[model samples]
Target: MSLQIEMDDPARPDVLALLEEHLRNMHELSPPESVHALDVSRLKTPDITFWSVREGGLLLGCGALRQLSPEHGEIKSMRTPAALRRRGAGRAVLEHILVEAKRRAYTRLSLETGTPAAFDAARRLYESVGFRECGPFGDYRLDPYSVFMTLDLRPQTE
Candidate 1:
């Protein structure tokens, strides 16, 4: 796929639409309290880095990374529209986030996602990229509807 992944502003019309749909889907799959997806304003914060994946001007997916501290980060707002799933857009955006996190020298990356069946693909994608189940990492508390995962970004030394 000829995908273009770029760090972008969340205020773009197309990106805002995609983020809106993502929030709606999250709420539909989980209760309001369990839906932790950030809105546009939150994604625009200086501590967060947002990215968009596009192909030929079509927005395929979007995601963001929130800096927890100098050495840790959190993945947020990862979404690809239902019609655009399986097109590698989500993975592209995720890989881009991983690279950004590493580039910033973050030693750890964590995320909270829903436990619902609707989120199975997302969980699998994270796992495929070396994310493993872990305890809540930020302000998040333990919740039945939420699953937490983390990836150790430190380079392996032989």
Candidate 2:
């Protein structure tokens, strides 16, 4: 399938529905206090750039990058529709987010995800893309149910 990823309006009804499903799943998988997924309204902020992946008009997945600083960004709200999981839609969205982060000159990218079994695949996906486990970042604090990961975007010294 030819997947196309592009910046999307969080207010779109279909996009809102997907985000709502993501939020619902996060709440179900983690404790209320540990759930960090943003709702559609929060994702509409200027600091966040959201994207949707579509194939022939079918929404495949979505993700967002929140600028934490001039040199850093946070990955947020990554979700693939149930029917599209394991089909590379999530990976496409993630790689797209990474490209955007680099384009914005962010030196590092980080994310907070759950520690539950439901998140194993997601964690693996992040690791596959070079994201390593990290400490709480941005406004986050250490929490038992949360797993924080980060990818360094700076070029390695020779």
Candidate 3:
């Protein structure tokens, strides 16, 4: 399928609507206590950069990056629409975020994904794209229902 990718400010109407839809879906997956969708207000934080993927005029998925430090960044709010889940939208959005992180000179990228059953597909996507399990970073601590992953962007010699 032909996909149009857009890296946009969260203020864009289309992006904001899709983000809301994504969070709604998350809320249904786990209890309110376990749901981890960052609030729309949080995405407005100065540390974050958001992007959405569209197929023709349809928003397929969205993802964001949060600058943690000069050399570190975190991935957040990654979601593929229920209809678009298996069609590569997640991969496209993720690769787009990784490129953006590197463009901003972040040498390490990390993320927190729910450990609930509904999150299995998400975890697989991360692993297939080279993210490896890591301990909690930032202000996160060990949680039974949260899986942490990280990717090192620095070059390494074979």
Top lDDT prediction, candidate number: 1
Off by over 4 Å in 2: none
Q: What value does the lDDT take at residue 155 in candidate 3? A: 75
Candidate 1 residue spans exceeding 4 A from truth: none
lDDT of 3 by residue, 1-158 (tens): 58777767766786777778877877776667666678778988989887778788787888888999999999998877666677788898899888888898889999999887888888998998799999989988787878899999987789
Candidate 2 structure quality by residue, lDDT tens digits, 1-158: 69999999987888888988888898898889888899888999999999998999888889999999999999998999886777788999999999989999999999999998989999999999999999999889999999999999998899
* Model 3 stretches with alpha carbons more than 4 Å out: 11-13, 31-33
- Give each prediction's root-mean-square deviation over alpha carbons: 0.9, 0.9, 1.8
What C-alpha lDDT do the candidate models reach, one value each?
0.93, 0.92, 0.83
Q: Give TM per candidate.
A: 0.97, 0.97, 0.89
RMSD of 2: 0.9
Cα error, residue 152 of model 3, in Å, equals 1.0
Enumerate clash totals for all models, in the order shown.
0, 0, 0
lDDT of 3 at 90: 88
